[model samples]
Target: MPSQDEILAVILGGGRGSRLYPLTKMRSKPAVPMAGKYRLIDIPISNCINSEIFRIAILTQFNSVSLHRHIYRNYHFDNFHTGWVQIWAAEQTMQNADWYQGTADAVRKQLFEIIATRAKYVLILAGDHLYRMDYAAMARFHWEHNADITVAVQPVSKDEAHRFGILKRNPNFQLTEFAEKPHDPHLLEELVSRDDPQKPYLGSMGIYLFRTDVLVDLLNNYPLDDFGSHVIPQAITTHTVYGYDFTGYWEDIGTIRSFYETNLALTRPNPPFDFFDASAPIYGGTRFLPCSTVYDSKMKNVLLAEGCCIDHADIQDSIIGLRSQIASGVKIDKSIIMGADYYARTDQVDIGPIPMGIGQNCQIEGAIIDKNACIGKGVIIRSFPRGTDLDFDNWVVRDGIVVVPKSSILLDGTFIGPGSKD
Candidate 1:
């Protein structure tokens, strides 16, 4: 097995996440809060720490202020240890006067720094994925196979295969062909594993392990910008590329619908991804807040974070984030409420009728309330009967879930439901 010191992990934080919309309005996609207490970037970073691969660099562009702060504040290595996590934001220099064109381009620009580390292998990962992976196992697989490049693949349903870059591997798991988002049924069938025709096709998980020399050569010779679109296909023809099959829980939380559904799934009795696994635990910043206090509230299947106050409310199948304030007579169901940044002081002046958190008599269902939002009293946020494809004043309905943007304020008695207009 290769030592962790010989591998440098680079997490690619993609460009502005337009799909996440209002959530990405103030913060980068990776920096966006997930599962109430942890941010999206924490998943991959935690995985690396668990796998004992600590030397890392996060390549980010687009609204990186919060992302930088979160990483710096949360991750701190011991003075004696050489392991460290650093952010390498995009910059315009004389050599490269442009932003990252794609994933491949981003890494290519940082090749100098990566090579300086003198690592034998490079592990490239996506910043927005939610999963737990032991990268050491993957590294061993790459070394045993003597592969120039090893791509981590997962079996996805035929219905979902069209959303990913598909690949066909031989009996030895050597990648033969690669196609990005193939729609043709004939092509899809060819991509399916020969072992079981009924089994789902092997789709790329966007996790890559590359030999240092091979990676450097490919980046320098190829002018391609993206790995999925340009680099991988080209590498398959000339270099030895193998597939590492991974059968685990993985979700790319790139869109609002996926993000909303993933968080809600955690509220289930048996969540696909377990955060309480002692063997491999997810790490997040420790905010020493008071324990949540509930008063005469009926709650079930809820993951309430620290510093929350619930009073005479009925909350079911929901995730209440840190420092969430819920008043009396409020009923919340099947929703994700990302709580406030800080507690409202007694001397704080009320900007409107409602203060900071959910007001009294407010009924919310099938919605995602962003951080620091002020929802006034008697406000009803529910799906539209006609269909949820409309944009209201402070929120937008997507995938039948009303999403209240960050720091938005809804006035008193605001009712949003089916057929809601601008």
Candidate 2:
């Protein structure tokens, strides 16, 4: 634990991740299940462990108790004297400000707790991304440049540059300009001279390295502005901010489409990202159970986590979460079900409403059934169930979204209506 150590890690896990909607409705984004088993929080936590950076803190709020419990049970290492990976939840007190305002302000408020442990530099990372990165190398790049702030940059298409922070960097990799979603002159859009290999611009990965003292000072007067919207761009005029180009398997699984698409990724032959690679495995906390069992079920190219029970069903291109149960004669296709339980019991017996269940002989075609919902047998739930195009009170969705509410029951052979899915 020397003063000259290259890095410390801060995981920004406080956001509600509302974009993920029903997935995040009950759990924080970091706690959302990924590729069948791993929670979103496990990504950065595992990355830090595998990359040889042990001391880290997860800053969490908004349904964080579950996220906290998962981290406590799963993230473990045996050989560290001064290194520990843990969490930092908001503590409402008499003097300090309450709750996190934003990502930057969250760190700004927790300076004492972070500094209490004597970390030299703070590496800020997000909790919702899915990628395998050697952050140790990225940190080394930061130290070599003596950068006041170092941002991980990647080359992105001009159309996609609007989706992220765009940076204009000089030949030396010194960032010249940063735009938080520019209208035109996209990041990395300019053509490089035929003789030069460097691209036009670099897009920020929303990952950054900040010198401890410099970060504290800058955040102190940061005026409640975010790193992307204000701190990064403003710092470019004076502070030494550099870009580190990164090329790897990285995706922000923050939206429903992205989540579904990512699940569909595993089905590809020799996919770009493989979770089962034992050598470079993305370590998540192992559930205390044997591998998932499939009985009388037809499964193809799906990712099923431990503790799952599948019986007499056809599941394909889906991500089933931990401890989930798929009953007989059901078909779940191209869906993402996160460790949700579908039992036949609940407290909604008054109006005959009950807990969730997707029953046998049911066709849940390209639809989402939220947690705790009970769908009866022989039911057809879909935006276009049979393509019958029948004239019988036909249901037409606004965004063509269909959802089965949590803790509700659809009677046998019932047809549920649709609206914006998320």
* Residue 141, candidate 1: C-alpha displacement in angstroms: 0.3
Model 1: per-residue Cα lDDT at residue 152: 98
lDDT of each structure?
Answer: 0.91, 0.70
Report the C-alpha displacement of residue 154, candidate 2, in angstroms. Answer: 0.6
Off by over 4 Å in 2: 1-6, 185-200, 341-357, 369-373, 383-411, 417-422
User: Candidate 1's residue-wise lDDT over 252-355, tens digit each?
Assistant: 99888899889999999999899999999999977889999999999999999999999999999999999999999999998999998888776767655568
Error of 1 at 345 (Å): 1.5
Write down the worst ten-residue block by lDDT for model 2. Answer: 389-398
Query: How many residue pairs clash in all the candidates, one count each?
Result: 2, 9
List the pairs of residues colliding in candidate 1.
384-418, 385-418
